[model samples]
Target: MSLAVGAVSSSKNMGFDESKDSEEKSHVSESSKNLPPPSPTPTEEALREGEKYNRQMSETSLYATEEEEDDEERKIELGPQCTLKEQLEKDKDDESLRRWKEQLLGSVDLNSVGETLEPDVKILSLSILSPDRPELLLRIPEAGNPKGLWFTLKEGSRYSLKFSFKVSNNIVSGLKYTNTVWKTGVKVDSTKEMLGTFSPQAEPYTHEMPEETTPSGIFARGSYSAKTKFVDDDNQSYLSINYTFDIKKDWPSTS
Candidate 1:
């Protein structure tokens, strides 16, 4: 019996089969334990989801930026208009001449000349010069007789000086035919510019010069007056203006 069993064990089928099965099982177990982690798949659905998410985020950020830009544009579009008053308030230190732009916008009695005369006044050639400050050169041709037409600077503690005068019919008021009006504006070094109109509720009429002066003693010490002619108490008038340019300073070395 022992010999027969030994013969069977030595048979090729039994030994070879058993060895192959055992080797296969061992390989499977070892490989399973030592296998690499699963790789991330580039599946169509996952790729599409990622792409959609990125596009949505990009669009959202872009839309937010666009909205901000639009808001800024609107703010820039709706700003205040630049009127004479605004210019005066902003540039308070420029005292070149009496600007009639505000008065010419509407019709009024400029310098109180003859019968409600409304001559067309416009800004002509304007030139500026200065040493430590800027000065103005104005050419106003339509102002009536200017000599002896004294301009009284408004009196006050304020550093600003104002000149105002009225022209009446020579026949009616026995006043001279003063045509032109001339007066020094605020001090050249003043930080404030002349304002055309203060009351916005009313129609734009006279212009008021603002006060802002630096004490440079570059004072306005020249003669200024209006030339004028009157027609009737309520009718026609012609005005011419002239002024002297007198400032004790040399020309500026550079602009």
Candidate 2:
């Protein structure tokens, strides 16, 4: 009886130990399910590193392409280049234009030129006088005057031309005298030379002609008209007067 009781107790003890062990094992398994995962292998780590490197290289290539495109766009914005042949042709065209202008200016007439008159000045009278015969104040001959009443001057005779002028407001800085002779309404001879320069003067000035000689010889004997031109300080003509006179071979005998 004592041996059988001992054996039964031992069997009970073994069953209790086994049940405890199984419960502990179940708790361990539950705890293990909540734990973190394991570390990656070397192969997986290498694949990840290669993917990052490839992404970085793609971005770098894109940036370099953008820079190259910007440079090309800037080059296109610049204007077309001028070649040496085009520059030479432009210079030749400019030279041709200059020569054409010079030729156009060379064809102008200078002899028959006349300047416009300034209205501020006018000539009052112009007459011829002989110093040798002071009483001979030769005036313009009238149709009703005696047949010999015209101004008769011998060849090589010295005479003075008298002129009176009036200026409205401006000053006369210079004076020019031009003499022209006409026969039968046609100009025969003329003196285009400037006679003298005068100081600045106001209106109502009288200028005496310097002593002059009449043309000599047979060709000088004829009806003639004398014209005198007066120019102002500005080199512009202001007044001109005409006088009729005759050249004779000899003076009339004084009775």
Candidate 3:
């Protein structure tokens, strides 16, 4: 995860490939796992110098900490938490430390560093890409548009989903993307993607999921309700959206 390593070429709308049709549903499924102890919560370190010092770095499981809603296990501690400013103030004298701090923080307002102790992530837009047909881009309202209809996809068409977002406040660890789709009250598709750790930076991050093809035939074309959510390892939910879309036999008219 943390698939935003490469900058995605920007555009207002989802651009269609116009070439050969390809791709399928994109999902980074997450298997529920327990969060053992706590590895240092990135630059935002935490906890005691006793057992904390002795704990192995591997304790913060490489996989994302599953949602607390479905998991019965309780959250221990990601370590003693501290604000972003606290992390940056530890070593001011060393030149290397100064440079690394700048590199990690990136254009952050020094005055606002103490405003929030938790990481803030904003989901901007969602791009739906299907080969050879016009793609769709869903712009998310600041408050989230979880009502009525959203967009449509072609039945049996191979497509992928990508998201653009911005992170502020502090570093976000174990960022997870979960989406569950349903048709006529029956759950059809569920996806959980673990977007790895990311530091706060001026620029936004773009993540593309694996490709997915819609179910074909008469039964596949219809309206569907879906819910998408973004959450961090510490169980802090950033945004949740509920929307509906239709799947048609042919692509909707672009003109």
Candidate 4:
């Protein structure tokens, strides 16, 4: 893995590099790092005192991710699309291209191909993994899930988030995700990571974000709000959601 300061590991079979869709480069840090607060957006700057972000409800959201405003700066160029079958058939006369295509295809099941105009990326689940601790996996609903504090994390513990997803139809390019976290209406953390491009395959791909240590101390424990989004290079959003969670002194007992 390329080890993007704060991203996770992915197998070589996946696209991109350890820094492979490394599956991603991340912008994540604990509050203890004293990351400077995100600059206020123009729209945010114009809000009146009564409507400032600090007092906003979770539904209205708790942070500002400047990604949309600066899309072009972060955008990666994508090439013309070709189905795996078509690509495999093309330049079959060339030995080099054939070998390259073989490596890219990597035992991918040909029958899994589907007829669709655009690639469909389905996020299956999200999990929280920590050394010596049980995995906390969140089942993703097809639509919006009922909003609430779904789980708890032990403050100061090391943990990472993992995702499982499937892609069908055409190839999805620059697959990535962003996560922004807030506490008591103040933005605390944000991240963007590239999972790289992927071919439509029968099996789902799972990516685990690099581990993060939750901030501890008196002020860290409590309820928090988070917004997570999954999107592609073309700016297509597969999912965007607002949910709640908590960091506490101890993990919740399974019993």
Best by lDDT: 4
Q: What's the best-to-worst order under TM-score?
A: 4, 3, 2, 1
123 in model 3: Cα distance from truth in Å?
Answer: 1.1
Query: Candidates' TM-scores?
Result: 0.18, 0.39, 0.65, 0.67
Residue 13's C-alpha lDDT in candidate 3?
36
For residue 156, model 4's alpha carbon misses the true position, in angstroms, by 1.1
Candidate 2 Cα errors over 4 Å, as ranges:
1-119, 135-150, 183-188, 192-203, 233-236, 251-255
Q: Which ten residues in a row have the lowest lDDT in candidate 3?
A: 24-33
Question: In model 2, which range of ten residues has the least summed lDDT?
Answer: 108-117
Clashes of each: 38, 0, 12, 8
Q: What is the lDDT of residue 255 in candidate 4?
A: 89
In angstroms, how far off is 241's CA in candidate 1?
2.6
As a whole number from 0 to 100, the lDDT of residue 82 in candidate 2 is: 35
lDDT of 2 by residue, 157-185 (tens): 78877876665422234456677788787
Q: Candidate 1 on 1-255: residue-level lDDT in tens? A: 999988877876555677787999999999998889889889999999999999999988774332373354345332333433333345445443324433423332323333322222222333333233334343444444223423222111133322233322111211122223345542222121322212111121233344433222434444333323322222222233444433222332333
Pairs of colliding residues, candidate 2: none
Candidate 3 C-alpha error for residue 1, in Å: 85
Q: What is the lDDT of residue 21 in candidate 1?
A: 78
lDDT of 4 by residue, 136-230 (tens): 88867668953577789999999999989999877788888988898888888989899998877778999999888999998999999988888
Give the lowest summed-lDDT range of ten residues in model 4: 20-29
What lDDT does each candidate get?
Answer: 0.37, 0.58, 0.77, 0.79
